[model samples]
Target: MAIEIKNTQENFWSSDFGKEYTDRNSRDTRDWDKFYLDTYGVTKTTINEKILGNLPKDAKILEVGCNTGMQLVGLQKMGFTNLYGVELQPYAVEQAKKYTQNINIIQGSGFELPFKDNYFDLVCTNGVLIHIAPENHHGFMSEIVRCSKKYITGFEYFIEGDVESVNYRGNEGFLWKADFCSIYKKTFPNLDVIQKDFYPYITDKNLIDCMFLLEKK
Candidate 1:
């Protein structure tokens, strides 16, 4: 499916896929948090040990689509301060606020974040963009980059090739194209991709996701 471009501010807030993915993701969190915890010991410990170990502590961090604030807890455990997050789902926002007393949790769209320009030392998005409409991906990335002062980190799931497809998570969003990373690099000329590696998530044996670290030049 070719991605349709949407420009309305309301669509940004109340996206169809966002609502669907939130519903599914929240259900997964409620049902699978314990199972995941039992299998992997400590909140995001496995992922953090693998992908997030190199990030700078004490930097202002903003996590987009921070469901249940698991990432916040992980960052705090790693000695990170000045943490903030934005979650579109009301339940997720409330759950995230309950998880972290110091972190700021805002309910808004990733494309239209409620913050001043260059507000964060790092902007991070984990498993969020796969649900966004493809045509709007560039605009959404622009918004994220605009908010970041020094760096941007992302955990993204993308498929290679011209055929468009939605991911296992139920959403009409963009799948990864092999050249999408090139597109991102071109969009942010000053943001140099420092590290990126493709990793297979054990949860789904067939899928491939990558963790990326980008620093401003």
Candidate 2:
């Protein structure tokens, strides 16, 4: 039997709302490329090349909350062979398997990742952290840190100040933005920053997205 999800955010993402999100975001590789280009002023390929190009092609990498596995597919295209993903919703998991080849995409929660500690060379989340409630942020970060053997990375909505909740699709209490990199560093003293950069939204320069890589020190 699967583990029970008790958290409100987890319950929210694992329900019909999550299925709708999957349906809305599911797109071809070309569309994804265009999306990154339009939103971040760069392609996913370019972002991957910048952040991950130096790592070995066979590095063990896992993506937390990898909806539909498009990020894994992009990594595969860049010649990375060992890739894995964990997603919450079964519907998203099904979509991921159909979209990816030779990649392991499992249905699991980020809060209780079903993996051995220090198993992955790099564990990452993209646009997943912002949805976590502030009260659960520490536990969530701890799990990601526990699974990462060498590096932890995040690409998320960023605010320079304290955590700020934002309404999503007109719903409150489901989304937030903060200085996520700083949070990780403060929460886990052993982590050291490798790379950190902010990309402004194309339409609104004041709105920012961030990507950072943290190494175990």
Candidate 3:
């Protein structure tokens, strides 16, 4: 049975718009390597090594809004055996299952993750939080914090000040950028920063993306 999506942003991602996104973003491992290299001047492997290499290969990792599971594929290639993903769109979940091996991909919502509290060693999101509306940010962050037993990590558009919405492909109120790490830190003080870096868009340096790993204290 499909869960009822209550949030407007959640509905948007579970609709045709989200399926279109899934179609456009169904990249394999090689494609992701090139994308990270081109966009961030580093490969996904290097980024994962920097942020997660220290953890054991059996570490349980969950990526919220995993799209088609390319990121989990990357982790799998790195020898991580326990990889899981939760995505809002059923199409994306199906695509992920088709492409990946030994990975658990499920259709679900980030707002109400189906996992128990502190169930995963690392909970992550990539370019996901920006799509959530500002009014629901706290609830979303709380879920991430609740599900993460040790670390919470993500990569997102970064701004120093208030939340700012950006028009995404002519759609309004569906994308936003802000200091997401600061919000997590302020909201859950038990989380301590483990690793942080900013990668600017190769074409426009003004547009920056930030990634961080935070450990629950």
Taken over the whole model, the C-alpha lDDT of each candidate is 0.67, 0.92, 0.90
Best-first order by lDDT: 2, 3, 1
TM-score of each candidate structure, all chains considered together = 0.75, 0.98, 0.97
Please identify which of the two predictions, 1 or 2, would achieve the higher TM-score against the true structure. Answer: 2
Give candidate 2 regions above 4 Å deviation.
none
Better of 2 and 3 by TM-score: 2
Task: Give a tens-digit lDDT track for model 3, residues 4-79.
Answer: 7978998888889999999998887788898888888898788878888899999999999998998889989999
* Candidate 3 deviant stretches above 4 angstroms: none
* List of clashing residue pairs for candidate 3: none
Cα lDDT of model 1 by residue, 104-123, tens digit: 88776676778899999988
Residue 169 of model 3 has an lDDT of 93
Better of 1 and 3 by lDDT: 3
Error of 3 at 157 (Å): 1.0
Alpha-carbon deviation at 194 in model 2, angstroms = 1.2
Candidate 2, residues 72-187: lDDT per residue as tens digits? 99899999999999999999999987799999999889999999999999999999999999999999999999999999989999998899999899889999999999999999
Pairs with steric clashes in candidate 2: none
Model 3 clashes, total count: 0
Residue 196 local lDDT, model 1: 75
